[model samples]
Target: MKMLAATLSILLATSAAAAPGDADFAKGLLKKGVAFDTVKGRGKVPAYAAYLKTVLVDGGFAASDIAIEPVGETANLHLVWKGSGKKPPIAVAGHMDVVEADPKDWIRDPFTAVEEGGYVFGRGAGDNKFDVSMVIATLVALKAEGFKPGRDIHLFLSGDEETEGVTADLQAKQAKAAGVELLLNSDGGGGGLDDAGKPVGYSLSAAEKTYADYTLTVVDPGGHSSRPTATNAIAALAAATARVAAYRFPAQINEITRASLVAAAKETPGQLGDAMRAFVANPQDATAIAMLRTDPGSVGQIGTTCVPTMVSGGHAPNALPQKAALTVNCRIFPGVTVASVRGDLERAVADPAVKVAIGQEWVSTPASPLRPDVVAAVTKAVAAAHPGITPTPAMDAGASDSVYYRALGIPSYGVSGLFMKESDAFAHGLNERIPVSAIAPALVHWRALLTELAR
Candidate 1:
């Protein structure tokens, strides 16, 4: 009778270990509005943190293995699964914060995760929340399957990626102390789809442009509109702004970008493809450069870009402004110094009176060297999920938290398995969403990656 009781107990425990399906887990996370009001300083990150803690505990992780560090209104969740301790821990990170959205501009409430047609719509659904859900699901599934990793697996979730990324900075420090080997960021790269919604290829981001903002200010004596003169502050500011706008930074190619363009050209046919091929073979080809510039997607990949994003001149329409200012945001290419870019802008203005200053301080990280082991693992996982999909290494035009890790000598690669049609993605815009089909495949891919790398 005691033996029978033990057998029944084992069966019940096994049944309890099973986790929810991938689609269900993703839907639950989307409904939480984790990114809503994230920039307003009233982010829903705390609520999301509590929910994740519960999920981990239920998935059989010891409470001591999971740590939630709250930084101001934001938070970071770290989970550790100890293994043989023979190799450095493999870290996977994704951000919970997302850009703000307004309901008036959307077909549905931006915070409410809605399923329509074949897609799931909500803020952060595509930008990052999708990866968050996938990471959580992978952890839960691993625990339920009774798999033991050959090396420790660490999962880091940051709460301020869209803002200052304070949590990521803190996490990087901790990771370095823990002797982490490498980090695979789910928030950076993924598969690109063609116009027909067919998968073109997978991209692994090895580098990213630096994001910096500068302010151009012009000050002059106050005067009435009726007494306007050539020394008008607004006019001076406008002219300087125009000169800055007309300026174009020179085009330069790096190892990662060169490889990306080459791969992209193979997938794309016709004149555009020919141009891509020509530009790689001869960077000084004017015709090839002009042809590539016709496409907005290829423009940022080739050079540094700066554009006037915000402007403010007069305080009152009837009065000549005492001071005028405009903000020019630039994405500096790798190896370019911030000071050089600022100097270029000042020279373009050609106005001694117009003061140019860095509006915000930004860190520039060098490109990480491509790791053949990482490439092989990612390729294997991609093939397991999507047969015939080719994984290519590329650099991100925008920035991500990966820069923090890369700066600390830890090579970070963006290798997310999520695939979305380019036309269907609205990451930071209204009605942000991802296809329902994209979610399950990503879960499978992440699980495979974790198994391959950790084992």
Candidate 2:
């Protein structure tokens, strides 16, 4: 019996020593290039899943505690560190799949993780892979430190989030069934930094705008371009599109956005700061709204925005087009229905010739309430990790899988502690990268947050 006990102690010590630090884990995952093809729905994701399993197992988590469920071409990795049955489990989630990257478009191969000038250049380095690595590193670090939570902590890594989010939706349902209480998603909110890389503030996203696409088409009989009729299809489509461009959705504010603006105003110095303060005090302030309109960064947070993304008209230069269409994509504010936005577009156009139809179904998700417990926990964590950086609740302009979990009645907040310059965030664009300085602080933030909430 004494020999068996000694062997178990040695095994535990070996597992604890084997856990890697946050930067090392991130480099390892980024090197795998778990790039997912939104169209084909496959990539090196299976290899990435195997990598995560190996890390967790090496961190001393039992094989039974980690479950890898395959869904189509991707898989979901769930790791549970069980605790006493006193509180519901808290789930930390990030998507494993990354958007496709072409080597020609990037300075270096997007799949290869390159460390240069205090930044990690890779495809998923910023979008989500860093967050996933942070969660894993934090959990492994906690295990190595011999810290035990009073409640279960579940790490959910979804395989499809940039495209279909099938795995996230499935896992959210599973988490709900397992009686998970709160979800801290790492894909949405984070710290915004200034030009000098100083922290502006950290945003905890409580809500996100809904995504809806609309198609406006004009149909007419084709004719010779030399003898074109007044009722040209292409011309009508162009006119309709112009009206949409000229139209602006009304500016609106909610509790979360109000707080965000208020926090931002405090940090800002000049007219921008004054404008933020005015808008927060009186959301109907036209002067402040006009000033904010000039700054693209501030405008998106205050109102629903619609813009024409795609347009196609003439088939031949010699003939009048028979049909012309434009795709209008809108990031809708919370609580607004897609039908209402469609009605607004139809009214704005006011022409019977152009037909506006829904290109995709709107998925509605209610905004998460700013629960005091969550706010306090996040605030405390931010204070510990980043002194003097205020924690502000925000509403994200882009949609995330958190909406699905929010729809399921589990309030999910985006609490990623990464701080980076807005100009450096090339997510879904060319040559994505993350600051090396941002990584260690993120690990500290996650560790502090998990300890605060679960312990």
TM-score of each: 0.88, 0.88
lDDT of 2 by residue, 190-220 (tens): 8888999888788899998899999999998
By summed lDDT, which 10 consecutive residues of candidate 1 come out lowest?
31-40
lDDT of 1 by residue, 331-354 (tens): 888778888999999999999999
lDDT of each: 0.84, 0.84
Find the candidate with the highest TM-score and give its number. 2
Q: How does model 2 fare in lDDT?
A: 0.84
